[model samples]
Target: MRRATTVKFKYRPHPKQLQAHRAQVDELLYGGAAGGGKSMFARAEAILLCLRVPGVRVLILRKTFKQMESSVLPKLLEEIPEELAKFHASRYEFTFKNGSVIQLGYLDKDGDLENYQGPEYQLVIFEEASQFPENHYSYLESRLRASGEVAERMEALGLFPRRILTANPTGIGLMWLKRRFVDPYPPEKVWRPKPSEEDPEPGTRVYIPARATDNPSLNKDYLKTLNRLPEDLRRALRDGDWSVLDGVRFSSWRENKHVLKPELFPISLLSGRKVIAVDYGHEAPFAAVWLCKLGNGLIIQYREAYAKGLTPVQQAELIRDLSKDEEEASGEPIEVVADPAMWSRQDAGAHKTKDGSPPVGSQAHAYQTVLNRRPIKANNSRIPGWALLDEKLRIREDGEPRFLVYNTCRDTIRTLPTLPRSKTNPEDLDTSAEDHLADAIRYGVMHLEGKFSNLDGLDDYVDTMDPMETYRIAQAEF
Candidate 1:
């Protein structure tokens, strides 16, 4: 048996892995295709960091205990020589002779994060990071800290309080992970948010993309397995494509193509039909969208309102308030559409219908009591609604996507891109995610079901109420 020297760890990094090893961002994601050596890079980094800093604390996590055992632990054990460290099976931790320790943990459910609330670790690494929720990743970042001697040791190398996340672009956390790391800029470059970004957390983050071909040592048959997956899944796992998520209904959505600023949207230019679409909720988010159906076959979400714990009356008042600008802009009455469930009868908690006694009525009745405007029941047909929404995302002849969301409509922009198609019925949205805003968008698009669907009349269908286009055409003839 060979005793370890001061630097006994032996490893050779491929070009892509070397980039992961060298990135100095506070947050780093080594992501992409499965065989990109993401897992191996995590293992090597943990070993090299732990081996370098005596008394250092490193915490590596997976979404489940099974994953901790199957994917992380075995390979980690193979990396660290026996004499340099002592592995505790019960604790799932390694203690080095130099007083450094590496803890292995799992974040499987909502309560699992509580296990880590009290601890501090200089380095926190998430294996298959996309499997955990954004909150889990976010909350754990607070735990990345060191003090006293460990801080002194880590700071010397400028390596204190760092995060390493490895993912394959498909998981519960895929949207947030992709949004935070992948979407902000070009890949393989360090990204820092400007002051105007939604999350302008000043810390530097980098996304290092990798694929199976980057590792020559990888088994050739793994590529075959990746190749056999469905197109969306294969694109995520085999091609390192962040754009396509498995079962994501709206793969056509691109922030650059669809989400527009005020300069590009030109809100003052709309003289078209408008509709106020609402998906009502009390404890959950009450979501609404002011959809402007413009003369040029462009659909823009001009205004958005979202809040939790608002009563039906409050939501109704909110609708009127949100509609005033669009109504004034279009110089016409805006149509109001709401969830069909609003019409369902509810228990009369306080007031009477007409007499003094308590009476059962619908939320819609309460809502109309405040605004005096009855909301039309939107078509709740899931397939056709999603289909209409999907079609609106297409690029028109003008080189802009027909469906455009204002940069200020943050909730719609946030949740719209994350709606994945259901596994049971691929045509419908998976209702598990935060889909209230998307529901509102769907209702708004479905309201335009007849117009602009077939290409024969898309350009031909001008705003019936707005005579501006007619005036422009007549003026051109003179």
Candidate 2:
């Protein structure tokens, strides 16, 4: 009699991979430097889930079909033992004898998600998730539900619904992914999501940051190739530095050297001019940055207010409230510089009054009415403004940057470094990205640069009032 053959499969996962497999978080982001074996880890986890739990259904996604076929599919096929599972090429799925299935797919377009509407997946893995848009990712998150039977089976096997994502720092979805996963907590630290109105059923989130050095299996030649890449790409891929992007607009931005601790530069030391820069948006996000110029020609971004869906009056009130303490202490109003677009009147559709009559005035005028002062129009010169800001970000001979952002300015710190260069216009930043805070910073920087450039002599202007009052007057004049 012919004996039945038994196939034994074994996978020795790296430490990071083991951590990811053991993590009980609902959503886990395993990202960072390239060649860290992220894809291998994802494939192994997916296979294990399919093998251990009957009726387990997993959806593995890539940005493009070709990518999924050429890279992920080949590795998956190589790893799965022949006797354990059968690959159905037509459906792009693997079926194990235990009734579990692993479906390989791609989401290349915005509307691609509609194809997956009815299917519920116990595990959804997004490979190169940063390449996908935020809306697509959120839509996929809604489909991460399991049937009662499947849930019961998974629970019996110590498995749960998991959303595993792997990505690098560069991509269109960089901002939202960073905000959602990488920015909340330190690497390898698991935290329960805080409940919020928008996210009532928030789940546990974890970030596992890996570097090229972490993967000993990576070939030395491949390491050399990564090292030989341009400075930005090298930092992003080799060092796993999220702050640096491939085509970053602000090459001068160095977070470690440019960002300052709040204690080091206290609000009490804010002696120079104070300026508030606003980039208004109702549909997108409205961003406001408060900058304080010190006596040593250092411009410190101390505070920020970034929100969306607020009316002009609401934004004005928020700005006023944000600056209230400083304004009171200084005994004068802080200078407000805003986007030039705010001055343009809008009477087309939504701007109409309750009775369908044209609205009273422009957004800037309404803001002024609520703020009790007219905000000066920003220079709105993109190239020059960016140049000035870039110059300010440069480190001086004394090892101090001319411009420094306080750690509290999270939006600015997060968005500024990630802003990419415009493909059409290399000189300017890509405005389509999350550039509101960067725009505000540019406006503040331009205002300061323009104000100081016209100054004939520093000694000519003198004030008898206290330093705060004098600085306030100077700001108002500017």
Residue-wise lDDT of candidate 2 within 1-478, one digit each (tens)? Answer: 9999888767888787888888878888996889888998898888888888888889999999999989999988898998999999999999998988999999989778887998889999999988999888888887887777789988887677889999998887777888888776788888987888998878889989887778777788988999899887888888878887768888778889988898997987888888999998999999999998877778989999999999999999999998898889889999999987886676653443464322358888777788888788777756545656766887778887889999888878888888888886666788788899999998898787675434444333432234344444444543
Against the true structure, candidate 1 has what lDDT? Answer: 0.79
lDDT tens per residue, model 1, 1-478: 9875664667888999998999988899996888998888888888888888898888999999998989788887888888789899988899998888899999998899899988789889999898988888988878988899888888898875789999988877788887888766778989787766755566788999999999988999999999999887888899877767767878788777888787865768866777888898999998998888877667888789999999888888888876676667666667777887887765635443453211236777766676566667776655545656766787667777888888888777667777887776665678987899999888787675543223243223332423344334422321
The global C-alpha lDDT for each of the candidates, from Candidate 1 onward, is 0.79, 0.83
- Please report the TM-score between candidate 2 and the true structure: 0.86
Q: What are the RMSD figures for all models against the true structure?
A: 9.5, 8.1
Model 1 clash pairs are none
- Residue 448 displacement (Å), model 2: 1.7
The candidate scoring highest on TM-score is: 2
Global Cα lDDT for candidate 2: 0.83
